[model samples]
Target: MNIVSQEHQKSGQQPTEQVTYAAPYVDIEPAESGYVLRAEMPGVNRNGIQITVEDGNLVLVGQQQPLSVSGEALHRETRQLSYRRVYELDPSIDADRISARIDQGILTVNLQKAENLKPRRITLE
Candidate 1:
């Protein structure tokens, strides 16, 4: 896993745009077949989260839009932040069986091991 402070991302208006990326806290739970990856991205909506797997890497991204108000600013703390995290997937993980869902700012990704890698009991003939 890698936590990047800033990264260059492409935008429609600008060919290259510099973005501040924050890595969200993540917890890994080990299971029989595989492990469950849970990422905590507060204030991020379901549509704003993106997950992709490519080149033996799993990428997670979260975007939070700036809050709008109809008055002069007095005190402001919360700001728009983009979260990104990348993890190197194991060889036993079945990329095709990976699935994810977001609920209450928590994104849960289910990583399943390939059938060939799973343990099985053999019966005596």
Candidate 2:
């Protein structure tokens, strides 16, 4: 099983302001039933995440809430960061059974194998 990440660019108002999305570090674990994916997404709320499956790919999007400041800031590291990561899903994975949840800035995605891909037992003839 292999999951590949592709870089994507986000259009900005100004041509010089083009921003490239940062892919969060992910941890994948294989299981007998399927695979478990864990992604680190700090400062992202539950409502800020969007998960979708399209064209044999799993897409993960997270929008960090913009920081509010009454006075003008002299300097800042990340003004408003957004996350966009896409993973190529294997054909054996059942997209319909996929589920995800976020807890303490950690996103967990459960990928279940297709019914036909599961191991079966055969009776002795």
* Best model number under lDDT: 1
lDDT agreement of model 1 with the native: 0.83
lDDT of 1 by residue, 18-52 (tens): 66677888999997679999998877888898988
Q: How many Å off is the CA of 44 in candidate 1?
A: 1.6
lDDT by residue for model 2 over 65-107, one digit each (tens)? Answer: 7766799878877535677788899889999999899998899
Flag regions of model 2 displaced more than 4 Å.
1-20, 69-75
Error of 1 at 103 (Å): 0.7
